[model samples]
Target: MPKLETRLTRTFNLQYPILSAPMAFAAGGRLAAAVSRKGGLGIIGGGYGDPAWLEEQFALAQGVPVGVGFITWSLRKSPSMLTDVLKHRPVAVMLSFGDPRPFVDEIRAAGARIICQCQNMGHIMDAADIGADVIVAQGSEAGGHGAVRGTMTLVPEAADYIRATAPDSILVAAGGIADGRGLAAALMLGAEGVLMGTRFWASSDSLVHDGHRAALLEADGDGTIRTQVADIARQIAWPIEFTARIRQNAFTRRWHGHEDALRKEAATVGPIYRKGFAEGDAEQTGVFFGEAAGLIHSIESVDTLIEQINQQALDCLAGPATRLTSDRP
Candidate 1:
């Protein structure tokens, strides 16, 4: 099999050029550690700087070179958590949903590469300014918060800009990439690797609610919608330009385009939303996933998913002529 060798693999010292996205409340220590143990880098979701949660997940990711990702705007409020995260000496410190500039120097001093997840081309320049080792070009199709650009155009565009300005910077593609074909396509688009979230969110090791996982399996690409309904219902103060792609449910339908209405009804809706999450009520809550939800038909182990992606990429790269004719001879 061809090694998934690239700047990503070399930088993280991973066998497969994959990063298990640190999806908040979804990817915890077990999932991250599992991916890391199996040759890919695993990233714990340190969403909003929950100290106790972060501590528990870090403990669970004991043996692996686990990294941690944070929503930058949220992380700013709890800067001490960054120090706590670095104490573990992760392979990389991933930041998304806001500016990563303030944390770059501290992350480097702690001996971890900076992985800046950018939702727009403008953010890519900000990351480069901070000398980020890796820039994850996350398009609008991604499950979580993202900007308007699509992955197809944005990945290569960012790659070209980075190559011209920061030759040593590595580029990774995110958003809507879930399978082997996606991985292969990313490489061809000038990215050295991929940041996987939705696919891994349905994995066995993921901390996702069982109800959410079941619903995700039933959902296709069309089943998801990009909107701020969930954020509004849950009262998360996300950036105005970024929207989350989540599986359609009653909650989304009830408040889809009515952001103002949701806000007006926050007192009543917020409690219900929190209850739905606590109870795993699919109808009452939305499941965060991407357009790649179409590619995910079954819930499998991370090991199985990673191996499948690796094999698929190898086959795709080899082509039928090399795969079939060589075996015949």
Candidate 2:
């Protein structure tokens, strides 16, 4: 009913400048298709390059035009997975947490737009240097793995850098953006759109465990902390510079400040962690989300959530001008 168009909308041919983040193990085919069907682009998370899982999710999308995202560093271990995904003719390919340059040519050759998710100015410059079609400025407030920069400062700075260097590359904002207020703020900060993770992770269509979703609803912004505990427990070997943000629980309380200790006990703890994760034990497993957890109170369908956000953003954008008058003192 309400529309706000920007470079991102035009470039992606979408009704709204919204893209659902490809959260690992959570954003699945159903979630991706739901977002896409609602006029926003959705990306299935191809975390750690599981060929079988990727194929299954693609099949579940049921012919909907959706994209796929990968943990770039993990993708390096099985570069052939990219080749396989390209065969599906994904509308876009998103690379995050590693150098996207190595796979740029192949993605472009496949006729899919390239979206590089960058954590800092260097990453932004690198993405632009390689002629990325879309650049997402992802801040530390984002769920899962990310570097230390905050979204507020990183986004406008990224916008300026992209404009001066690669004018054709459009910018999107990520990290702690869950609702229409955040979408409106991103537009003001020079982002053409917002790429959301935690919000979508809580959507009914997402693949998050019921316990994890329950934890998300109960969490406030302060309840989350950045740590290496989950990665250590899962033995993910993420780059040292990036840490994951997850809800603080008994597991984190015990392991957050003791990385070496966690490593020492990983053999004993890892299996327990895996079991907890599989069983949806929120206290023992990592409830991955961001500060936006505080903003989200309910789990709704992707289409309903998108429609509400779009209309709320339109209202917020128009309200400031209408409520302000020269006669006001």
Candidate 3:
């Protein structure tokens, strides 16, 4: 990829205006550090506030310039874990799901940049009100949990919202952003950069199972599913308003709209789901991802993927396709 620069790179002090989303356990220290080393920001997913796992990954990072993210509600339960991690002084602290206001003071007191992943304009405003250093507009196409809004409309709306309310705050677009086209489109929508999950999940450094990665490579965008009760029934305890997006499989097909049934089957289905995770069964183990999965045909190194995406964006923007053809009488 050719050399490219954007506001996000300068504002966030990132080598590339690209970011690897905190994909729960999928994006562990190795993956996060790899992306950070490869000129992008890598945030270790402090998913559901697992202090032990967080500590283990932080150790694995070993002083790399990476940030850490947490699902806000879970962090509330384990307040001390956040305090402990902050002692290391991560580059940034990203908070998604639930209100991050209560913890913003502590995060800022540690001299860490604050990145709030917002699900809507209201959330964006709330993050700005809390004096967030940066706002990541996470549209519904994002993997794992999110609200109900497509990336195309949500990104631009969030951008416009921030531009009007907090012009100085940097905005990054998330959800279904995989290739150069996605990156360029985000910039057009008023984002300074892009935060990616599914694409990175398929990378060499990600903890995603090899078989699962292979399955994602074989699948297309249309294969993804967006559901709510699946995660709730599994006891993940995501906020009632947020939902998850994953690859559609037998499980989703059977329970997608059947929230009532999922609630009823939770007792029996939960055990099977856990078994699938241990056995690495793709049919049962959820393949968490976004629509961008269609653009990802192969699993490559983090460096290669990041470089290609940046280069592709530059090439497309410099090309003539962006110009309009007009004929006048």
- Measured by TM-score, the strongest candidate is 2
Model 1, residue 190: distance off in Å is 0.1
Global lDDT scores for all candidate models? 0.88, 0.92, 0.84
Using Cα atoms with residue i matched to residue i, what is each candidate's TM-score against the true structure?
0.96, 0.97, 0.94
User: Can you write out model 2's per-residue Cα lDDT over 1-329, one digit (the tens) per residue?
Assistant: 86999988888889999999999899889999999999999999999888999999999999899999999999999999999999999999999999998899999999999999999999999999999999999999998889999999999999999999999999999999998888988999999999999999999999999999999888888989999999999888999989999999999998999999999999999999999988889899788999999888888899889988898788878977653221112
In candidate 3, which residue ranges exceed 4 Å CA deviation?
Answer: 322-329
Q: Give candidate 3's TM-score.
A: 0.94
Report the backbone clash tally of model 1: 0
Ranking by lDDT: 2, 1, 3
Error of 1 at 165 (Å): 0.5
Give residue 191's lDDT in candidate 1 (0 to 100). Answer: 97
Model 3: lowest-lDDT 10 consecutive positions: 320-329
Model 3 per-residue lDDT tens digits across residues 1-329? 46567777887677888889988879899998999998899999988777788889988988898999988888888889889999878889999988998898899889899999999888888988887878999888787889887889988888888888888888999998888888888888989898999989999999888877887877888888878755846767667888888888877877778878788778888888877765656777577888888888888999889887877787677877743221111
- Tens-digit lDDT string for candidate 1 (1-329): 56779988987889999998989999899999999999999999998778988989989988588999999999998899999889889888999988898898899999998999997889999988888898999988889778789999999999999999988889999999888878888999999999999989989899888988888878878998889888888888888888888888888888898889889998889898888887778888768888888888888899988998988787777777444211111
